[model samples]
Target: MDETAHALGASRTLWELVGRRAGLTPDRPVLLQGDRTLTFGELRDGAERAAAGLYGMGVRPGSVVAWQLPTRIETVLLSFALARLGAVQSPVIPFYRDREVGFALRESRADFFAVPGTWRGHDHTAMAERLGARGVFEVYGTLPDGNPGVLPPPPADGTAVRWIYWTSGTTSDPKGVLHTDRSLIAGGSCLAHALQLTSDDVGSMAFPFAHIGGPDYLVMLLLYGFPAVLFEQFAMETALPEYRRHGVTVAGGSTAFYSMFLTEQRKVPGQRLVPTLRLLAGGGAPKPPEVYHAVVREMGVQLTHGYGMTEVPMITMGAPDDTAENLATTEGRPPAGMEIRIVDPEGKPLPAGADGEVRLRGEAVCQGYADPAHAADVFDADGFLITGDVGHLRETGHLVLTGRMKDIIIRKGENISAKEIEDLLHQHPAVADAAVIGLPDPERGERVCAVVERRPGTDDLTLTSMSAFLRGEGLSVHKLPEQLEVVDALPRNDALRKVLKYRLRELYG
Candidate 1:
């Protein structure tokens, strides 16, 4: 967070690119976790020190370092630290299980890794030990015996990768998307300018810093010279006060996270709901109509929805003053210098209003995947990155995502996305979270089965209550789950978001 760090360099590497913003407002609060707060000056110094520490370790530039630590201020500092040295830093989401973590460690070819002695409910050292990395930093309360390895070369060309982001891998293996210095600045500038961020903005970052939204928010905040207040865990009660106390104006996250915040705000009807929040941007899934209305009606906060994936991230994003229908249903048109197309199964572009595989061609589209073989499969002959999503552009030119081609449930010859049924069930007040999957069936090839996580402590929620709720929501009789498993919590992958379709098929079969 050095107020004058950006003045020290002239290049657009992530280090210099983000530092420019630091000089503009170095004393601003850039990070806050629990009681630990670091201003822009402090954050910059910490990252520099962490970079120095890595440099001392002999971590050569252009090397890959996969760090798995919780969402602490230290994690954020280490990211820019690695970036400064030109080592492509990759973070394993703190909650990722062994299967997800192991895949990324091997796939990314990590040279150095940092993990806690213990985190949440798992042992970290044991996890990294199995991966056989060259170097490891084990720090929980303390790690005096950590290995500091060789440093890599800084960027000689703009084409060199600054970082590698892996897709969530809901239906297949994760693809490592290589992001260059130009792409980072392109994305960072787009997010910063679109959100109307300035040097005065104070961002309360509560999303998982490991994901695109969290890291993207931090980079954009730095590009705007704004300070971000980081949160280790997202809870509505504690989050609101930090925003009001810090005079935070911008909050960036998904609608699911915002829904939880608004749910908690209902209990305290005070001055801090939307106190001074000027910008709110949502990624991942768009907010449902009911949740979208609640934010506007109750808190008077307007939120814009954005759409992106790992390969061609940030394809389309809604504007701040966009209409309600746009916010609830579709993400806005593609950004400048980007062309989006609705394509048939054969990769031919379709006319407007026809839903097919969504594809993008532009500077924002990635160079290719980390692995050449995998790249050949997902990338097309013409070079457009094929997003597995199925969507169509309206007559107005806005994109409306209807379904994901891979997420389709193959039953009764009906193509359906799990999202369609999940969105329907989410309308039920008694339902906290729900996941739909195709299960084995005797007559039909497969049947719809829902693994639902009811709101905590709902012993009195009878099956009759759920049935009536689904009936009212107008869910097709065929898509209804024949049997519902009311569990304590939905199973989540390393991403810490619910996707139990893989597990659902296992159980029902």
Candidate 2:
């Protein structure tokens, strides 16, 4: 049988056939908060209503709708609502000041929108009022006066356009990753099996609802007849209680998020939450070494270090219970069914261990970017999604991320990769966070500099200390930074906590 039928037989796509199981375990909790609870049947009812509402508004399949929401119950409902109507979802990670939001709105060409009047203390409704679309639903406050009835009916086979994720742009032009019903069902099914998701598991999510991972979790949980728990913020204080309250079995967060959680527990390790958590994995960015060490030893949660892009999330993931060396040292073997290849600039596949641009081919890979022009530069001749990232596949089948092809820094005649320097600095315990950027230099043309965020209350990180640490690690004197700027925090895009290299270039350039 074909993949689509296979997925249906396996009961994937929670919004599709996935919800048929909803009535099977009606009384069982479908969603849970400290005091709030929604059974599987209840959530299904709300989803039907939301779908009906959007349908009533005339949204058809392939309609692009953007959602700017915090981690909340409504976000999940809105997502399934769009899915029920078979319209595409364009989720923007929250609180992007007016400029970023405006860019996403205009670039995505969104037709309908659902945002909070004000979310997390920002006036999203007021900001979005200018959008003036056919339908607007606000949750943090009010969506305004416009109210459409129910959503349109689900589209026919192969017609659903699910998501349009925005990626960091090159040359100041943002790209929107577009996926079809085929990809979402295929990808979600891939995750359902890969993460070992089942009806019994409940996930505690710290990522934003607008992000692929957040909604991915939501869909996966519902796909398997499981529940999703949300935390408004990723604070350990709040996350812990929610985990205990909701009986959370799986929890997700970025590696940097884990680092912050570790930082928060410096005073008392026993006070930390997330005790019953069975599966503890991370994605969005490479895991810092220290964060990996703590998860295994301190928190006792297995860490699955995942490497993926918005174009195709979870291309590779380090399995939990794998050696700490595997999770920390390399982004482990590709998850089941996903494929990875390293290619030269000309797109020829490279031998194992050769660092070249990483291209991914999988059922999960997106069809194209919303901007056709950007999509032109994103695919290989055979249709593999060119993920701009550079890495190598070891003979052992493990993938090690080297850096970005575009992040090459040229200092005088020396060509340096910023990721190399940043990876070196991350090994230092004093270095909680670090980013490297190339700055214009009259003499060298472009020289590399390091900006580091130290552990909170660590007053001992000095230029000399950092240099000595690098020297001890046998880093080349040439590779050593001429400057080390200490920062309280690194600028981060909403879902990804990776070093905002773009912000670094802007600041230093």
Candidate 3:
């Protein structure tokens, strides 16, 4: 990071960071949408006005406010206003309906709720009313405005738990992960440092701003004094114009995003998809080596994948200057002060290069879950957060994630990493995407199943052909998939488009 950004990242609170950046570059654009641009001065001044407006509505310091708004400049203003008031804010994904929204409001005991009215054909205000939400209000393109004189002093303490982000509730009810301002700033700082971005770079927020990544990317922008284009609804075709319009230099959300851009590039083989684009960086799902190679070779861009979760927003990130072998095969090294330990099943620390559960200790780690019931299983006795992810730290300090603990397929007491088989399957020309899952088998306890999405116009892939390909790739016989199912498209979440494995298991099992 540059000297100015390094100084800005030291600001105690999110509001303080905003103030520092605004003071330095008041007129520079911080956020850009269709035709609207919000400068740093506007962000700070607008947030203060909104803070006073919220104060008029009975929102005070420590009051819990929940919002389910889309990725717009208004959303950023409201969130920062809450920060200025020192209120505990709970940000719910706009795509979440009654169930998840109700759960968050009830669990957080929110004193106020903000909705986008009707977004993407869904009446969020009506749904909020149905759930009996308190202090429900609409903040689509407008926000409550009042004189800054009505607002009290901004928050000074950065360690207080002031943020609650929910996990994607695919299988069950969502869990509210707690975070403080300092932790979030730390997460964003590490990410900004690793990517080595500067003020000259124009970024894009293609994912939901309500996700944990929202503050992460925002802090990077604040620290670097750069602007990012916001996409309320992101699709490759729809977002391409915005990318070109704003001259987006750094773009990506996850592996799925890279693949989507690659698909677009394939249409016009030699032409640059987004002429100004140079780097693709993101984390949230596993990145296959083949995807990394394809993005670099075909799209002519540097693809830097990272490893992170809701609990810790930026664990490890691939740098732009990393070696090809390291970038393709491993997630980059953790930032300074972020300690990564690979531990065996018994919780003993394993040597470097040993595959084990990854544990982390860092300033960026979340304090704990909102529900104390879920906290016990999240940390080890040593105080490191037990990231159910299975991975190893190489001697070179790179992280090599194999798969999640739950993703392991145990067939007749032998463990098989679904990622290992999926990675190999991704190399198949006829296969566009694949998810390997284990289904119950009466005789063998569990049988390996491969669910695939065929490439367009490619020949159908059968179990016979897949097995032969796996064998030729040197996969063991026992690890070979016993079943194969092809689907037109794999189920994915709205934010990052990670393959929903649980959904596949429910559908195919």
What C-alpha lDDT values do all the predictions have? 0.67, 0.68, 0.89
**TM per prediction:** 0.75, 0.75, 0.82
Candidate number that wins on TM-score, 1 or 3: 3
Worst 10 residues of 2 by lDDT: 141-150
lDDT of 2: 0.68
The digit string of per-residue lDDT tens for model 2 on 395-452 reads 8889998766566554422335566567778998888888877776533435668899
Leading candidate by TM-score = 3
List model 1 lDDT by residue over 1-509, tens digit each: 23232232224576665465566567777776666777777766667767767777766687788877777777777777877678887777676656557778888888888887677666788878876766888744432222224334445565677677766433435567788766655655556555555677777777667765556677666665666777776666777778888777877566556666576668766645757876667666534556666766766777776776656556777777677887767877676767887889888989999989987787666677777876656667776777778889988778888766567554432334567667777877767888887665433435667778788655545656766776666444545566677777777788777475667667666
Superposed Cα deviation of residue 89, candidate 2 (Å) = 1.9
Error of 3 at 417 (Å): 19
Weakest ten-residue segment in model 3 by summed lDDT: 166-175
**Model 3 regions more than 4 Å off:** 168-171, 406-509
TM-score of 3: 0.82
- Local accuracy of candidate 3 as per-residue lDDT tens digits, 313-394: 9999999999999999898999997999999999999999899999999999999889888878888888899877898999
